[model samples]
Target: MTISTTRKLVGVSAAAGLILALAGCGAAPTSNPTGSSGGPTAAASFKPCIVSDSGGFNDHSFNEAALTGMQEAAKQLNVQFRQVTSKSASDYTPNMQALVAGGCTYIVSVGFNLSAATIASAKANPKIDYAIVDDPADANNDGKTDAPNIKPLLFDTAQAAYLGGYAAAAWSDAHGTDKVGTFGGMQIPPVTIYMDGFVDGVNKFNADKHKKVQTFGWNVATQKGSFTGAFQANDTAKQTAQGILNQGTDVILPVGGPIYLSAAAAIRDSSKGTVMLGVDSDFVLADPSVKDIVLVSIMKRIDVAVHDAVMAGASGKFDPTTYIGTLKNGGVGLSPFHDFASKLPAGLTDELKSLQQQIIDGKIVVQSKATPKAATSN
Candidate 1:
């Protein structure tokens, strides 16, 4: 959570001085002032903009985390920034284009759904820097990423999801039920990637503990799973959660944006002692109302990545190289068990920590073909 104050000051000073100089002339400010004090006044023209996926900015998962990062960057770096939310897939391009037309120096597009739009925008405007989450911006729809202006902020979430799955299995075992499950908002790579790792982790737990833990929603072999059709459909998500719970699942991971809210509501209403796992951001921190039902979260650290990207762009150190979040670099990992930590079986937490290190050291490989590949070279 520590940010470099010197770096922040540097960016702020330059941007602030530009604003002051412009103010000295007859030109009016282009955007609202950041209202930062003492250090320097940020230039209204050096705005950073963000376009959310269909889930909007308050999805309480992926989109919210990214928006949080942008807000942090705006505050710490003393930059003016704005955001546009997308209500549907059709809104992606138009939202991004609006930000581009608004004269954003750096445009961050949240989620894989915006990949095509981001790639097209980056290609059309090479002068503006773009950062996209989830997808690598494979312009041709090929597996390889070739866009030089689009920086892909991806996560090896499988690493963290594996830890979460193991923890969930142990929790279920302690509860005397060997059933756990996971579902997604879509069958896309980002969503399936979490399910893949969760399944593997459960399988690993079964092998290590000699337990017959069963996962209900996702089938790793066939790459098929239950999905709510879209990220924002709480009713469908609730129905899906109820179905999984009916199958005796004591723990469930919902790998969608705000869909976790639906899962939380289901777990709460059922009153069956069932727990839920979260994705993208830590649910306990992001949605405290659901903390009682949330066991742990597979954190993608999207906010940190987005904040750092903004810092880099503001300081003129923007690199086109893709940023891959992994357990090795603190980019992606498991969140604290919170209220459930003390309730966990003895030695379970230690085992998860050891597994994390093992994965980082390459002793274990949390791989899934669904994982989006980072560019070998920028």
Candidate 2:
């Protein structure tokens, strides 16, 4: 609808810089982002372009899920779609420019790393519709996104994570374990919310059980934990998992996507009786063998959210505020208790459902911190 840009030096050596410069001048082609309820792009003519983060498409995780959404939108809306993969942050903005220059409409960025690059490009070219997943760009200190043209897709994982924590706690206790742990892709909200809700859920379960169950990694109240620096680095995550095990935590949860897969592998090797919980996607989907041992999963509905966003873009209605994923909204939640279903007391499942409703109904608030009530002096 609007195309705006300031003189930006697209260094001569930048990837396809000359092509992008030309893209800034003319109308880009666009197609329906599959399932676009809004009819058709104004141009009735542009293709959708999406850029992937370093993890690449088919990660069976975030990137893969997002790509599916794009492809779905493309197919449903009767449009063409193309995606660029960036191996590093430097490629972010240039990739945006390249797509814009290529005369593709609606350039979409796949992850938080693309925030700045996407924003820069959005500000410069008002005509190109840009969408980013997981991070909202907040130019003002008010903690809200100031960009009217930029669309951000976000998730409130803490809510579902709490349920996941409860599930994990229940699984561990039923199996005769008491200690657990967690980690994240980074210390940012996109990832940490899972750890926070998870810790809160476990703490509540322990409090109700009146038993001291120790957990490491995420401190719900403080909203912090150890991060693996990046989500794609499996080796570091595996090491982190091993370290958690060394500290005596048997149930480990890591919320950093593929990185947690490595953590799962590490836990499978050296724990006395460790159970690994997954995040983002169902671990059982990744490995059915792990299904037999999976305690629970802190599920994020990235697939649905991304698909919805693409549909919205095609329809021409975009909301830039954070899209928090919750149990009520089905944005995030615990997966069905697959293998562990038979192992849990029947009443336990009812209790968890009741707790989930309490959370949704605002009766129980899972504090983002683990502060066990101090022992009373007898």
Tens digits of lDDT, candidate 1, 1-378: 122332232122222222111111111112233564543333455678999999888887888888877887787667668999999999988888898888898999998888888988888898898888898888665655556777888888888788888989999999858999998988888999999999999999999999999999999988877999999857888999788888989999998898888888888888889999988877777778988888888877677778778767776766877777766656666767778877999988778878877887799989987776767433
Candidate 1 — what's its lDDT? Answer: 0.78
List the candidate 1 regions with Cα displacement exceeding 4 Å.
1-45, 141-144, 376-378
**Best-matching candidate per TM-score:** 1
Q: Candidate 2: misplaced stretches above 4 Å? A: 1-43, 221-224, 286-289, 319-322, 366-378
- How much does each candidate deviate from the true structure in C-alpha RMSD? 8.9, 13.0
Q: By summed lDDT, which 10 consecutive residues of candidate 1 come out lowest?
A: 20-29
Indicate the TM-score of model 2.
Answer: 0.81
User: Which candidate gets the maximum lDDT versus the true structure?
Assistant: 1
Worst 10 residues of 2 by lDDT: 2-11
